[model samples]
Target chain A: MACDARGKTTTIKILTGLLRPSEGQAYIWGVDVEKEPEHAMSRVGAVVETPELYPELTPLEILTYVGRLREMSPDAIRDRSKVVLDEVKMSEWADKRTGKFSKGMKQRVGIAQALLNQPDLLILDEPTGGLDPRGMAEVRDVIKGLGRSGITVFMSSHLLYEVQETCDSVALINKGKLLMYDDLARISLWRKGGRVEVEALPPIPPEIVERVQAAPGVKSVRGPDGNRIVVELEGGDEERAALLRQLLGWGLRVRSFKDVEMPLESLYLELVKESR
Target chain B: MATEGATQPTVPQAPQPTVPQADRRTARGARFLIVARFELMRQLRRRRLLILLIITAIFLVLLIVVIQVFRTASADSYSYASSFGGFVPTLAALAATFFGADALVGEFEHRTGYLLFPQPVTRTSIFLGKLVAGFSLTAVTLAVYYGVVATATAIVTRGLPIEIAYSFLLAVLYSTAALGVAFVLSSTLKGTTSASVMTFAVLFLMLAIVTAIFSVADLRPDGNLAFAGGTISNILSGPYPQAYPGDTEFPGGPGPGGRFRVYSPAVPLSILVMAIWAAVGFGLAWALYRRKEMKG
Candidate 1:
């Protein structure tokens, strides 16, 4: 599963081989998380909500410590940590204490730590939460790259645009309930409708507005600009053709025609409203 | 086009090997050690710990000098040494108790616990690692104090006896037990200040007030019926009473000065009480930590 900043994601860390779920079981590469959690979690890397770095330690030192927990050799830890830090573009600040790092730098350090072992499942929550636009792009690219490398990326964020741009598939959750789970394109398909900006040859007649609203498969009709009326159709090409014919039959001139794609923010708000 | 594509060499492939499961486990252990080392290093670098150690060391040195000067001035050196030795356990207990009371509680107050809980490692490992580090630091401080006392005593007396050495060792052990009690209390208390206050209050009540009541009851005419006083006496004498009066004289008293009195509770009972407290405290900390939600 992959999620961008826009989707709601929930992550639970059940310690390797120590805890069993109260309701269900989780598996890691066919190994039960509760029964063989160590084996299962060995292939998992996570960057929880906050950067878990020790504030007193430098970024390099923190990475080295986490590397040691994995029992990596001294040379391997040094090499891997160097590469990860460089990947996160934090090598310049590797020696600086984490307490002094900005929010974006801390987020990068968190990502670097999570990517250390290159686990099969990389779970990140609001990975770009505190980053500026450039930092957000950097993290988004890193996550996309991880997904390309065959890692399952599960992320959750309140930013709809980020999720739409980064995720291949999304599961929309609100108040702990699943709203929609599908490919982004499929969700975006729900936005299909013909939108036209109409300026009458002379001027629009009230009779034409009534006639268009009364046409088949016309969901709604509104005049956004004085000279333009946007008609939302319920069907695809067939509905659009029928509406155009009816409008022409009413002697209304169609100045221009266009299709509108719903923005993710609007779609999210619509889903949230529908659920409620 | 096909020939050109074929002629273009692919990126060099690095050799990868399948590590055995045992090897992977070893790797994880290494990672845990790195984490443990980082934890220790962080504590070592703390200004508070450094200041505490420095202040403790200076105070210990001055305390030894004063004790030695007073011991030499008093003609009854043996009685003074014995009395002083008896107070060592209580003093050590008081220090360790207060130190332990702030151990975990302070971390919570500072919101540092959240940073460690979400890792792949279990809470047990985190707790054990921190406890080991904290205990080691406390032990080192206590050892330094012991060394200072020993040196001062030898200088004052011109030689040291085997009994003093034994008593000092026992005192160290009692301090460890007291530290365990405080550690457990630290985990139980919600706030660092409250934990410290409660720990000191409990130590003072048990060592001083309880001992005083017991002494008063033992002097009562009818030994059979002082309920609160008798209970206090039993509590003091039943387990780990510090000083037990033997065949030595009571110094600076009207009666003969050869009577010996035991004050603190017995070592074995103190150990048991401390162990139970540690166990319960640790158990509660583990449960609460395991269930705690990590907020961003």
Candidate 2:
């Protein structure tokens, strides 16, 4: 969806009917992109990277113009344009020239343009690239709302956290090769087992490292401090209990046991490294 | 189990709602129009475009003023009529060429093509729409200039011959041809500067270089009509011509000075040439635009 080139985010164009895969086919709503491009693309609304707004036209005029091209009645164009502008929180600036808009505002306008037809499939590349925190939240909420409305959103972003927060599923690519493709939650689960940090009552003995390493389902053991022992295990309730039992069998006192959620950033790094 | 079986057997029913395909098509068409209209309006609002129009208007006014000044100073109606009427088409062609040459290339330079190409509209529609807008703008300016000049001339002298009206129409046609050629160049060249420079250079070469070459060759001894015809032929083939219709006469024996020899591109030939250039230029532009990757 997106990649960093010299520290700038570059999004690959993924228009519905335009691009054809070398080995496979892309489709939109069961229409094959290659064979039935017009039909395939009919249901899609997309903005590649930057807003392609005409700087000379007001946002309202722009929406109406594109609406006319779609053969919509004048009233429908106006109604939809207003609705979309409001949805993106750009109603106040709709009358202003797009050339004068801020980058964030332009991105919002781009989103509104993409949503104009109420597309069944919306492909946005870095839809929130230039947004502030609140703007990003608004965009994410809008996307979430679209998903609820049964619009399949396929978006690309370099921000792992944003993708993690926003996407229902993702296909990660590196060097033009697919690295991973699955639900975000499931991919995170697959990357590495969740970590458990324990504060030993009697302090973890350096000599008991071998015993902890030999514990059932305990993949690795390490200590950053004298009182704390971090254990990596294969995830599952049974595996967790077996590791705890082994630790108790070793006569080690446990002061606390807490599971740490694996951050998507860390998982991404691990996956990238593994692929290499 | 017997009690459950005895109870009315319940079956899950699928939702029987239907959304006609026509409704979906209407939605998609609406989206395409939004993008197309936005593109048209954005281009119409550029500062450079406004400035170009203003400059053209000022030039037209200056031409009128110059003609009036000459008439007042010398009390010569012939000079004023000849100077102003002769130069209109050439001036219009130059103005149209200057603006139209960069129409498509400017989009590439600004990286705005990336934004429009992804929508549902075909590349042909985008190219044609932009071309239509550019032509409309040029035509409007030319019309205003024509009206202004005609009004000024009427005020300066009693009235001009009907031939001037014919010349003005020819000028508009010539200007449109120049625009088509420039649009073609814009599509061919990726850089704005290169496209602009090359388009103007070609125009000049077609008009000046070919004429100069024919003069040096001494192709015609008794009459320059042969050379003029050759130059017109060359202009038709080449990308640029210095002297558009009514600009100046071709070099050789008989020039614009000859009362017996008239030097206008045949009306049908002019129309045909312009149509050919527009079709070819726009055809090439459309092809390149379709294949162009909006990577920026």
Candidate 3:
């Protein structure tokens, strides 16, 4: 989900049984969180908004502590700590104290502990909120890997790109209101229309641009941004292919013609603006 | 990175392990021990424990220096042990405030609760675990101090007073009461330093003020933990000090003040009062902790 400073964290907190809702009830895996928090929380492994670990302890010790809380056997904690630590790429630092760890390293450890219980559901809140580019990519990769492992991952972030890259479905919220909830593809292609970027040899004339614009199912043609022009086209794959063919027949040396990917940022902005 | 259209290698996922079903009592008991063990380790690693031990050593040395300076070599073993136990209440308060002042509050203040509170364990388990750990640390410190006094009494007076054991028991009771108060403050306060200062202040300054008021008003300060702690030393006196309530000639004569009022609760009553303080303090702390939220 993508939401700006709204109630995303609050909702996640309630779901994780951190806060008792003033009204309304929430459930996790058929168990009411407020009614049976221990049972509900047992199924969930969560990292809520920059979890801070005990600096005096090593990652191994911290994970062991969490494992014990989960009521796992000592042998299980040992074996599982190794696997989860490796999953987050924190095995090398497992025994090292977290006091002097970099933010990225600590974040990785946070993810590691959340995975220690082998929970059925994983919830992360802005896993890459504060990190360098490399750290963000690494964390995104870890999150994506977890998603592919079949554990249901529900993550909330304001970064559209991160959600776009890491999540299969998206839930957008604004002003504590859920604006939309659907698969990523559906939201990105909600209008049954998209922009197609065309790259051809330089010195292409304006007649071709006009012809492309006048083609059936084409909404508008914008910019020869360097060697590229973005054609706003309606309908699906067949119409886009037909337009590419017509452009080729117009005696234009079209090097490439591909549908421009609609960034989730645009959809998020539009949805948020419309909500307001 | 796997590119688009490339067949992604199937990574084996970790097995989803369900938490084993133990009887609720056994599970809570096991978790309590685990938390207490780790909590104890956390406290043991801190420099504050060492600081408290060093302070105890300094106080012991001071006791020896005073004994030599005052030339009280003829004092009996009971008097020597009583003098040693006299410092128990102050040391116990210091120990409780130092070890337990941030016991619960630190979880929120230092952001550790963000990780801890989401676990499957119940808040009751966490509270009891922390209380046991704090009590253990305080009790152990008191034990060590009393152990030294016992050894000194054995060496200097060539005899051990049986009352030393009772004195030690009262000292521990007093410390537990102090720790209970500290835990209450820790759970309710938002900052660790404030909780620690408030605990020390409440135990020493605030309670002392209440005891003094009770004394001046000619009411027995039996309910005051500060006044009740006097039983730790009073038990060692051959003839326990009798309550000279209302007005009487000063024990030290009218050298300074003319008349003085004294208040002393019996040993059994003092023990009961201290136990009540500890129990009520812990019960109140647990109640507050159960409802406390980690807003930050």
How would you class the docking of model 2?
A: acceptable
Q: What docking class should model 1 receive?
A: incorrect
| Candidate 3 ranges beyond 4 A from true positions | A189-263, B1-26, B68-74, B239-258
- From the highest lDDT down, the ranking of the candidates is 3, 2, 1
Error of 2 at A94 (Å): 2.0
Q: Which ten residues in a row have the lowest lDDT in candidate 1 chain B?
A: B223-232
TM-score of 2: 0.76
Which prediction has the highest TM-score against the true structure? 3
Please give the lDDT score at residue B3 for candidate 1: 14
Count of backbone clashes for each model? 38, 15, 0
Q: TM-score of chain B, per candidate?
A: 0.62, 0.66, 0.86
Give the Cα lDDT of each candidate.
Answer: 0.58, 0.61, 0.80
Cα lDDT tens digits, model 2, A1-276, are: 335642122323544433435566545555555565455555567766666566777788767665555445676677889999999889999898777788778777777877776776778777787678888888889988888887778787888777877788766665555555666666644445557787788667777777777777788887847788788876555676777777778888877776655455545555556667
Model 1 DockQ vs. reference: 0.19
Tell me which of candidates 2 and 3 scores higher on DockQ: 3
lDDT of 3 by residue, B1-296 (tens): 11123233232333444544322333655777778888988888776778888999999989977875774767887677777767888898899898888999998888788788888777888898998899898888888888888898898879887788878888999999999999999999999999999999998789989998887766788889998898887777643443212223345423355445777657888889999999999999999998887785
